[model samples]
Target chain A: MKEFQYKNPTRATWAEDYSFLNNDLDNSKLEGDKNKKSNLKVTDLNLYIHQHHILKNVSLEIPDNKITCIIGPSGCGKSTLLKTFNRLIDDTEGIRYDGSIWVDDVDIFDKKTEITDIRKKMGLLSQRPCPLPMSIYDNITFGCKLHGIRNKKRLAEIVEEQLKAVGLWEEVKDRLHAPASKLSIGQQQRLCLARGLAVEPEFILADEATSALDPISSKHIEELFVELKKDYAIILVTHTLRQALRIADHVIFMYLGKVIEAGPADEIFNNPKEELTRKYLEGAFS
Target chain B: MNRILKNKIAAGMMFSLTLASISLVVLIGMGLYLKSAPIFKEHSLWELISSADWQPSSGKFGFLPFIGGTLWITGIAVILALPVALLTSIFLSEHSKPYVKKWIFPALDILAGIPSVVYGVWGILLVVPWVSEVLAPHFVEYATGYSTLSGGIVLGVMILPLLISLFVEIFAAVPRDLRDAALSLGATRWQTSKLVILRKTLPGLLAAVMLAISRAFGETIAVLMVCGNIPLLPHSLFDSCYPLPALIANNYGEMLSVPMYESALMLAAFFLFIVVLIFNTSSRAVIYKLERKFQ
Candidate 1:
């Protein structure tokens, strides 16, 4: 097997070229900025499937421009909440939502709201990387093309820009027209991230995005998220405590379909206000 | 140790049974070749197929009409079925609700279950009249409606259930996540289907079409009844012609009275079997290769 290597390009070089990458905030500046406004506001959100309560009155304020890891045991509705942000799994049979998720001060579940229009605001990285069944270049431009960006030169630039952001351009630059599925699993995940970013969303919702990747690859993704948080609100769903502690600036802990504790990463991990949060953090029940 | 011996015995028996099934196919091929040997000795294979004269009285047995008719009918049938099948499969798999699909799918299965003879009867009653009375007068001077066009229509309808079922399976096998990946990018339902799912399943779809074509080739009773079985070249869709299966069916019982007739019919049967066998095997191979590549 060939050894895989790609440069993690500096943000300074990226910032000079792209308007979106202009924000380069360190920890203190991001923390200062978050206290002013939450990017997403969920109010009295209750979800049910076949008359069984899945999320019970789930309400939280997800901070803007920060990495907020939703960590809890499996089936605790952490993933369900992440999906609720984009209304991804709401179309499943017998699924009913009795809540409002306000993105940009508009209720997303309103009958008048167009689902596709709102979904464009957030790019979701699912548990397993699913590159669209297309060439690598087409995969990046697919989302842009959907939004009606027809200029050939512009599409080419967006493809190169997104790929370089995720450190995939150097590796896949030669094989731009090759099928995206042909890449290594680690590389495919990066390609998917690049694809997600090309759509230019304000928030990136990842549901255990690195769970399917090897250590080096997961580390690669974590580093990408750290760099990306300056410009995009990065919301991650994870069961791994180590990962949550590693990259999360803020943490939202949920258990039994309820938010147990929500605050800064150290505040939740070090001095948890709730006993359940402390126990969960201490590996009481994963 | 005793259980291990029993397990080995069972494995050995299963393996031999598998080998037996393969040998059965070889046996059939050998049987077909041997039965058709007398015809090979009588005429050169090229002269046998390419020549127009098929008179049995003078020992002439050209197969051009039957071969041409089969090709024309099959070509027309596939052209008619491909778009309808693709659209129907897409509708059932992507657009229809579960309840709608639940209702539609069993109907297709029931369509598959009905005998070909029934389809032929229906074709004679409805399609023949429709083509003769309503369609042919505009283009041609006269048509009996018992022509290649009628056979093609009936054959296309007959192959519908199989094509739809295969296409539906192919479309449905694409993971929901891949669709969601496209949908989340703000792509509409049709765009997602066209760019993602349809493109991904092209190889399997090709395999399915090949399988349906083979099935269409060997369809005997339905095609024979409506085709106005005359051993002549079909210059147009409305012209009467005789397909290979129809040729074998109409001539086999009368073959004993004529010397070269039985050999000629056997040769037709042999050629049909070989063509169908090659198509079936190669289509299966394509589908298998596609499965391995995707996985």
Candidate 2:
């Protein structure tokens, strides 16, 4: 419960260090400039979930190798926006969308985006830890098998490497055959993180990945995210302002399905811009 | 009485009821063993188990043929029923809508409630003639009213609804999370069913099948009507057969010789008791295995 402010570096501090903030506030201009370079972009994105227009004309550049944190209040369409990237929301009953989500220079919604390959490129983690009722080794190696990586030796190596990467290798090395759910909640969450990362995805989307864990677990996940961002660009949706401030390199503040504020994490947290963003940071409304 | 005394009284009542039921079961078992001690002494366990001759009048009472017939019929019934029942269960659990499930499930319950006598009568009147006239020409060439296949098939139908409904309940009890989790892992719908859902609920499904088999094993009237009550080993589906229950029912009325009759009946009952007991114990063991696995 702390009050935080995000300065619109585009509006203020238009100096040498903050020159990147001069991109247009509207998404169309931002996308045109960014998409000519990167492979993924949200172009004039609008997401209407059921009767509620969850995201209204929201767009952002999800750069190839940079972490983007979607920070917002509950039900602000942060997770909804992330789900749209992989067309997961399409599985739901009554979702209607009118926008373009392009991945790897191809419009993903263009009737040609194979969900399997799209999902292969982008691994996802939910808020709760979901290690399948399988062995620790198998849980980590499951997605690899799905992508047709059947070489057992290679799978064993990937399991070891991913577990080590998530800092869970030492704790579970000897008991790789043990059921993944037998681990503590913290360990289970890390196990799930390892599962996602084992797929070797270029982009990892975590929807409040550590929200259901204890503070210690949350801290470990945050550290893992920082380490992970070095390799895979992360799109994390979190309600925790402190979490966003701690790890997010770039922050997009969403409210009522709209981007209330967007800027670098440091500028967004330390300075003032939108009143809704400020109030949200101050714990005015969760 | 104080609260503690009241609680103790309640506990004691439950303990007494449990004690009574267990005692009754033990007494019945003991009584059967004691009553059949003459047969066990005269005929060795191997003779009782392996001998095929079932002539009780001259005291050459080998219950093996009846036991074998019982087993073969039950096995055939289960083999026939299991696939049909399992497929029905899967359809009900996975494919049927809520309204269809609600109505279809109760229809299955009504099938369960239909008496064995009705099934027996139906098997004789409706099923027997159909098999003789329609199915016999291509296969048996001289089909009779009583055959193992007819008995087993009718018995299978009788137990099919029970097995299907129990299977549906078992499969339905599988957690939605297990399905969703597998699906989200990029597994196709069929893969999810085959891998996660089926694997998780295998123990329950196994228990259901075992119970159905147990029911099929002990069923009497239906088997009696269709089994063409010959005491000989059936070579094919068209041959006459005699399962234990049919034998017991056949001989019980005209069995005037005391020791011969008593011993035959006791041996048959003993055989059934052992079979049912084994099935029940295995069912419990499966449940225990499932619990331990989850734990």
Candidate 3:
């Protein structure tokens, strides 16, 4: 129910500049200097899964090279909204959406668009730890193979770099040829992080990646997110308010499928504008 | 004090029942081994193991042809059934819709429950006639016999449901996370099934295949009905065959002639027992190894 277009100012560099007008709230006014560096824009987004509205008229701007954390209660549509960024919900059965999700000025819902390119541009790490039934080395190179980079030396180097980037190379460097399932739970989660970064995606979506991990492992993943935000924009959906405060630069607080309040993490945590947001921060409700 | 002793007595009674249930097989095995000793002594293990020709009426009994026949039929049947059953399993596990799977899966379960005697009757009246009358003449020219090929084909069909159902169960037990991980990495659906799921499930698949092979070897009625029950070594698939189970079935009742006939038949029983015992032991060993490895 919305229109999307691209504006090309240079031959190689492109930007997605979106504007929306509504009688309920004028979103175009929120489109300030911040919107100029946005890689993706969500406007009037609505999602229905089996006749249950999961997201309702949501609009937000995801800036470049920043970690945007979505904090909400369980079943509050944070993960569902994350799935829309790369169209991961397309494979979900009996799901439908009425929204325009734009990436670099291209409407992702266009029939001519391929999911592989979108998936390649964005890496998603799910809540549960999943390592392939393969060697740790092969897990890192699986993305390279999918993208048809067959050079052996380059792949080896990339695997090493990504492993080192996630701070797992020291523990697993000696056992890189071992099956990833052989690693401990904390180690496997870090291996999955390295696997995600191996593809060199511009954006990373983590759906509560540290929920199943211990405190030390949780801190390690938060540190990795800090290091990774320098080169990639990361969108994290977490039910833990403390987790969001620890890692996020910007936080979007959603309750019942609508954005309750969103701002810089410091302001949202120290001085929440909405009552539900304040109650959620105080642990009155999840 | 009396009530506590009664409860302990009941617990001990149940424990003994569980122990006896497993010990029953060991008792039967020991009894069979002892009963086989006289036959082994009269027919000198060399004669039974070396000679290929078996004619009880002439007082010469050898187990080579029957053992060889069992191996040949099982080998051929596995060759025919394994690929088809595995492919069907893959389809059921990964491709079929939920409603279709619900229907098809129960149909396979029913196939596993079908009686072996019914399979025998079908092989004799249906498969043997079809092979001899329809296919043999075109290929062999002088073929007037129901061949080992017919028997093996019938046995293969009989074991198909068993192999397929076990394969489906194992394939379904593979973790969905493994499949999702592969698919999320940009591997196509088929690639995910082939490379990740199938590779991870290989040890279980191999165990299923071995169990199927043991079942096929121990099968008596179906192979006996269709194999033509000849006593000579089969040089070609077109020739009639006599396997160990078929020999046990065919000669056990007709050995009223000399007392040595009983000994010879008992010797064949021992051979069949040893083969089955070896298979069961090896299957358990391999499955144990796989369980430890995967865990």
Candidate 4:
């Protein structure tokens, strides 16, 4: 059965679509040739969730088009830090934060900077594979359709491109109209990735995105992040230090809501560093 | 007793209890069918249901007027209640503060706990006059204080809390992650709710609505008090109509002297029983399928 049909959004509607999918991302095929160098500059950001100081005064710079891995134990505000970039935490009740995350001089926290615009620039993959309750083809095009890509042929092309991008087309091609929740966990995660990619976000924020998958699926995602680092600035929050070591270009070590160490992956993993970082690497408290 | 043997005994006990309940439903259905058999034997079932001539002395029992009235009131109740109930439940489930829900749920519970007789009295005291004096004047030429419009209004109010409670539960059961996925894709809050959460909960919402319809269909006292019991072919909202529940409730106790009348009433009960049975069972099946799918 045909599960999803587009209502041919007019050009005016497309113009007013959520940030219009950033036109430059359409032609961003070459490596190191991205139009904008949007490095997130988090300056002394303090967060309080339900009056609990969840994130201490945290400051860091996330480089453009690189895999930045946030490594820490559970409840260390790694996911919290990741959420602040897109202002997803604003939806949380009793959450108050004073953070100026400048995305290339445009502060995300600024009232003038539309929150949807800031969010459209970044993709999020949460801990679980959450397919929007629709068919496989619909799930992949869910974000794209919202950005007003109404041409049926173009939508089909996008669904094919994204599904193939995450290497899921061959597996799911025959059943495009099937419910996405029917897919296996690994396939569902890849579908989520493809859905996010359809939005053409410059940054991919993955919060333990592979923790729920099998080792093979976990490996598959790890390989994808390394490949996707060329086109998107990939931010990964991982509890597994080995995963951080394997794919991170830059590593951020956080302990109890504070960044204990931040540097190149090799430098942070191999060399002498902060005592807390070393002890964390040594499995002192987990 | 040995622990495993004790566990076996407990399991056997629970299974038997469940079986008994299942069989009891079957038994009730069979009993109604059998009791209503005499009337169907006397006249073809379709002939009896489709004919509007419901004269008792001449052995002519056409039940179309009562069925039409039942459908009319229920249609009104659904149309009035569904939109408001669905919207309020969505608000309660998604947008309202927990404290707001805390007071509202209890208030709804109290509304639900109030007896049907009280609702009928309230309809008689307020809604009937309001329909005749306030609402009907703008639309129709003539309308009695007691009419299908009043019955519908009362039945709609009676089912609102029931519908809202079920709808809220359905919406609340949807995973928060679905909403998270939508918003993360830069969708607006309304878009996320409508496209993702609402779509996911659509089946459950429909099942709840069907359950509400069955409840409205069989509601006797409230509908009877408001609906004028003049078993005529209902032409408009303001026309007096006699629903099946009202017919059986109005005549069953006093008219047992006429065996044919008793048989006719039994058939009406059978019709309601079968219709409600289909609604409840089918809705339950839909809910069960939804549960398995999400799980």
Indicate which candidate wins on lDDT.
1
Prediction RMSDs, each to the true structure: 6.6, 5.1, 6.9, 9.1
Model 4, position A176: C-alpha lDDT score: 96
TM-score of predicted chain B, candidate 4: 0.93
Per-model DockQ: 0.46, 0.28, 0.34, 0.40
What C-alpha lDDT, on a 0 to 100 scale, does residue B163 get in candidate 2?
A: 91
A-chain TM-score, model 2: 0.85
**Which is the better candidate, 1 or 4, if ranked by DockQ?**
1
Q: What are the per-candidate TM-scores when only chain A is compared?
A: 0.86, 0.85, 0.85, 0.86
- Candidate 4 per-residue C-alpha lDDT over A1-286 given as tens digits, one digit per residue, 9 for 90 to 100: 1222222211122223312133435333454553765567799999998879999989988866678899988999999999998988776878888967887678988888987777888899989999887889998888888888888899999999998989999999999988898999999999999999999998999999999999999999988987887788899999998787677777899999999888666666665289888768766223
**In candidate 2, which residue pairs get closer than 3 Å at backbone N, Cα or C atoms, i.e. clash?**
A5-A271, A6-A268, B146-B228
lDDT of 3 at A271: 68
lDDT of 1 by residue, B78-135 (tens): 9999999999998888888788988998999999999999999999999999999899
lDDT per residue (tens digit) for residues B1-295 in model 3: 6999999999999999999998987887776667667666567788887788677678677778888788888988999999899889888888776678879978987888888888888887887888778878787865544668877888898889989988888987877656656656667667777877877777788888888888888899888888888877788888888888888788777855766776676667777777777887897788787655554
lDDT of each: 0.86, 0.78, 0.79, 0.85
lDDT comparing candidate 4 with the true structure = 0.85
Better of 1 and 3 by lDDT: 1
- Candidate 4 Cα errors over 4 Å, as ranges: A1-34, A284-286, B284-295
Quality of model 1 by C-alpha lDDT: 0.86
lDDT of 2 by residue, B1-295 (tens): 7999999999999999999999997798888777677787778888877887877767787777688788888988999999998778877777665678879878988998999999998899977888788887888668875778788888999999989988888887876545544555566656666666676777888888888988888899988988888877778877778898888777776765656578667778777887888889988998888756643
Task: Report the C-alpha lDDT of model 1 over A88-135, residue by residue, as the tens digit.
Answer: 875466788887899977799998988887778888898899998778
Best by DockQ: 1
Give the range where candidate 2 chain A is weakest over 10 consecutive residues by summed lDDT: A8-17
